[model samples]
Target: MSQLLEPFREAYRNMELLPLLTETALKKFWVEYGTETIEELEQLVEDSPSGDSKIIFAGHRGCGKSTLLAQFGRRMADKYFVVFFSISDSIEMSDVNHINILFAIAVRLMEEAEKQKIKIKPSIKEQFYKWFAKHTRTEIEESQAGVGVGFDLFKIISGKLKADATIRDEIKQEFNRKISDLIARINEIAAVVQGASQKEILVIIDDLDKIDLGVVRQVFEENVKSLFQPNIRVIFTVPISALREVRMAGTLTTETNNQIVIMPVSKLFKQGERYINNSEPISEAIAMLTDVMYKRISRDLIEPEVVKKIIIYSGGVLRELVRITNQCCRICLRLIRRKPDDLDIKINAEVLQEAITNISIDFDTRIGNADYELLQQTYQFFTPNDPKEQRFLDLLHGLYVLEYRNAKLWYDVHPIVTEILQRKGKL
Candidate 1:
């Protein structure tokens, strides 16, 4: 690669593309979606009484759920004893059941309790271990025969809970049989934590959205009450794809005092007789996203128009925007190696177009004709019934269609999805 390309490549390599977690990372990587969604969610939680409360927040997988939830956690940390965790990190997401969720939360709660120097009653600890030992007899016996010297029972239990499917199933079945007991034990610990901390326990379980649709439905629909019946303030991050499959709207509304919040895509357009790109919101969003990359990489590596094009192609999906930007950097690296002039090397329009074309190929494979028609209709009419339409949900799940909230809500097809269909003369 030419010398000019070297600096650009180096800068691109240093860019932070992963999800933000730390306070510093969030400060550096933040982008305002310019909606009252976060405040509204906070308000609901703040206004509610200090009893068992659950809020269901759904968004597209990469549409900034983790970062937003983390932010929410920080905002509530001062007032609430927050236990924020990502479930997919520990459990089998595709096969996750309500039992898996409960165990994950229990493990996390135990860890946070230890961190905060809050002690669980010895009787409660013994009760928890007894429950574990009774349900996981085979696992305990196997571990005893293998590595029994000074074995920490809780450690063994936690490992088996995450790794052993049979153990997990047994615990799940036992919990199902004696759910009331399990609920009582959870409440006992929750009471202790709340009493010790002098604040309500706010359990923010993130990444339930990453699980399979079947698992999502099973945990949230078939057993919504079971999953959410715990006596703690809970906020679950659910996937946009599984939103329609969830059948507990009324139940969740009544239970959590109606704190369901949906984080929509950043508004990039104003829908009317003709779909017009709303320059102001679109520019502000693009500029903020551009800053995310520029914080690590030099903006000189990318042309301004190229950045705008990439953001447009992303269709306000923050993850997609960063992903395409990363792809462009890679493509630029390869192209720079073959180019004659080092100074001419830059992430230009052609490089972005090539990157988007590659992404469009994948979209083509995943999106079906019905999804295409739904996206097409969403692009044109912005129909009143569109949000409720099942096909519309399909398109949203596929990321073929994007949702945005302005003075009102609207839907539009991802620009890359639209571009590919137009290229094939299908639009």
Candidate 2:
């Protein structure tokens, strides 16, 4: 699978490597990257004393939370009616709020229930059709009123809700003044559906973290109670950096009464040790990351040591790791285009360094003097002086600062950002 001879396959593989949002991560690059984190989440969900567990799954943007959550949701399907969907597919990130979020859940609930062919009373199903039709301003004719019709209606309306701004705004206005009513309706629908399906409802909402932090603060901080009012188990994703805010973290923990579960970035080195101290990275984590590479691209395309170097530069973020390697592939592809007669088309030190230089420029440009100062201190101390400062949090959000979990939570500058600092004489 060298992909060099097959232009179409090479293009498809290149697209896969870009840092895009996808649900088929586990299906494709089936790495044992975060099974421990998934197992922990399973216990948090399945074994909850109160069945209505609302969990906040926080992690770096590209830390494989979606893949882990996909597996978690699949495992839950046997006993619970699993409703896994990305909020980005429903509402525009800028326009998202607590009201529209619950609205999306209710719509998705009915849609999934229909797909699963759950036997709900016709009256309850009609109520759902009418409720969605009323809020979304769509008409559901009485003649078109069976499971097949209801499924088709919701399918069309779901697309409109995602692709149409008018429907989203109408629903927002209809429920914005009295969100409790929205919560009540959701609970009512969930109750009937659960009774019919004979399983508890588990809603796993992804992509909520990709929104701006300000918007996340509004939906999560201002209306956290409303978010949990539906009486169904739910999992909400938030930026790992958002938890750095003491009030936000304190509020979520206080409300949930449990520790917030964070999917950690892959821990490469031990705390307070880098590559220089004769200190090796955790072998298991490194192997997991390397295994991920072997699955995607052949080892012949890149050297083993080169893959490890790319991983270190990736700061253990799966998306970044794939992206840097993808860059090398594109570099080699360009060279072959210029001269396909060359026998050796593999990625070499020159190509790998070029990839590093290309990605570092992006990080180098977004960072500022203040961010650099914070990075330098974080590099030296392995912790930010003011972890709660928005600037520091920005670094965390931007992946300029990476948080690693081993014995404790420790912070360090991202390897790419670190190299930039060294070149700038700041480290």
Query: Which candidate gets the maximum TM-score versus the true structure?
Result: 2
Predicted structure 2: lDDT: 0.82
lDDT of candidate 1 over 1-427, digit per residue (tens) = 3776767666666543567778987786576652477887787788777567788898876788888888888888899989988776656665588877886677667656655656555555555545557765623433232222113554555566667788778778878887777777677777877887888888988888777666666787778878887888888887775555435455556655667888877655566422444444445766776765576556778887777777667777878887787788888777777774766677888888888888888889976777666666766666425465666666677777776667876666778887877886766
What TM-score number comes out for model 2? 0.94
Which stretches of candidate 2 lie above 4 Å from their native place?
1-3, 7-25, 275-279
User: What are the clashing pairs of model 2?
Assistant: none
Score residue 214 of candidate 2 by CA lDDT: 91
**How much is 281 displaced in model 2, in angstroms?**
2.3
- TM-scores vs. true structure, each candidate: 0.85, 0.94
State each model's CA lDDT, in order. Answer: 0.71, 0.82
